[model samples]
Target: MATDTTTTAPARPPGTVSWWRRPWIAPLAIVTAVFLATALPRYVGLDPARSLVPTDRGPAFYPALVTHIFTGSVMLSAAVLQLWPWLRAHHPRVHRWSGRVYVASAIPTSIAALVVAQFPSGGVAQQVANTFLGVLLLTFTLLGYRAVRQRRFADHREWMVRSTALAFSIVTNRFWSTVLIAAYAPGALTDPDIGFGSPEIEGAAVASAWVSWIVNLMFAEWWIHRKPKRRSRVR
Candidate 1:
C-alpha cells in the first residue's frame, strides 16, 4: 500500500471586499458628506437654533436642531469605533466605554425624535413619517438590548445592525435630499423654500430611513440563512 499526503491551503478570512477592510473610510465619508449637507451649515457657522425655528409652524424646530447636533456627534464618534478591527486591539476598555456612551446617546436622541415628529414643521405628512421612524428606532433598540440580555448573540447582532442602520438615516436622509434637489432643481438643495412636504423633498427622508433599515435587515437575514439553505439544498 502507498500513502499519499496533500496539505490543504489556509482559508481566507470572510468579508465582502478590500474596501470593506477599512470600514471606517466608508462611514467617515458618509458622515462628512451628511454633515456638510445638513448639520454643519446650521450649527458651525450660523445660529442653528434660531434658523431652525418654524416661523409659521411652532417650537419644534429648535428642539429638532439640538437633537440633530447631539445625535450627529454621537453617531460620528460611534462610526469611528465601528471599525474596531482597524484599531489593532489597543484598548478594549475604550471600546467598551464608547459602546456605553453610544447607547446612552441613542436613548435621548430617539426620544427627542418621537417628540419632534409629533409636531413636524412640514405638517401631517412629515409627522406621520417621523412617527414611524421614532417607533421603529425604539422597537429595534429594545429588541437589541433584550437579545443581549438573553445571550442570544446572533439575535443581538441582527437587531443591533438593524438599529444602527436606522440611526444612520441622518446620513441617508441627507444623501437622498441632495439627490432629489439636484435632480429636481439646480439650487433646491438648501432652499428654505423647499420644506419637508414640498414635492421635491416630501417622502424622501422617510423613504430613505425605511429603505436603509430594510436593506440592512435583508442583508442580515441573508447572512444568517444562506449557509443553512445551501446545506439543505445539498442534502
Candidate 2:
C-alpha cells in the first residue's frame, strides 16, 4: 500500500481578521473620518482658543483646556488606530511608535481632565463623576504602559481597554446629552441658555457623565471577555 503525505495549514485563530485588507474597512474609515471632522475642529487651533479665552473661562482655563483638547485629539486618533489588529500584527514597529504616542498623549490629556474637573461647570454629581473619570483615565493608561513594559500583554490589553473606554467618555457623553436634552427640554425648570445651576441641566449633566464612561467600560469588558476558548476533545 502506498501512502500519500500532504501538509495541512493550521487553522486560523477564531475571530481573527485581516481588517486592514478587507473592503469592509471603508465603513470603519468613514466613521473615523467623521470623528476627525467633528472632534478636530472643536479642539484645534484658534477656533476653540477664541471661544474659550479672556471672557468665558478666563486666562487660567486656557492652559488646561488647550492641553486637554490637543492631547485628547492625539490620544483619540492613536487609540482608534491601535484597535486595528492588522496594524499591530503586520507592522509592529508602527504599532510600537503609535503606542508610545498614545500613552504620552494620555498622560497630559488625563492630567488636564483632572484640572478641568476641579472647576466643573455642573453640579456635585457631575463634579464627582468627572473627577472619577479623570483619575480612572490617568491610572488605567499608566497601568497599561507598565503592563506592556513588563511584557504582560493580557494586563496591558485590559488596562488599555479601560483607558480607551474612559477616553471615549466625551463621545458617549455627547450622545447621552443630546438624548437627555431633547427629552427633558420640554419639562426643564429653567431655560437651556441660562445657567449650569439649573435643575434640568444638572440632572442631564450628571446622567450623561456617569452613563458615558460607565456604559462604555461595561461594553469594553464584555468585548474583552467575549473571546471563545478552545476546549480539549476527550476520546
Q: What Cα-based lDDT does every candidate model obtain?
A: 0.61, 0.76
Which pairs of residues collide in candidate 2? Answer: none
> Candidate 1 regions off by >4 Å?
1-41, 44-56, 87-92, 182-235
State the lDDT of candidate 2 residue by residue for 76-178, as single tens digits: 8888777767777778898899889999999999898887776655657777888899999999999999999999999999999899888978766778886
What is the TM-score of each predicted model, taking all chains together? 0.68, 0.81
Give the Cα-based TM-score of candidate 1 against the true structure: 0.68
Worst 10 residues of 2 by lDDT: 46-55
Top candidate on lDDT is 2
Q: Deviation in angstroms for 33 in model 1?
A: 7.4
Q: What does candidate 1's lDDT look like per residue over 1-235, in tens digits?
A: 9776756555434332356655566666576566656655566554544554342345665556567566756855674564455331556677656655666677777787777777664457667766777777768778877886798968976776667666766656666656645775545565767665565554454454455445655665575566642312211
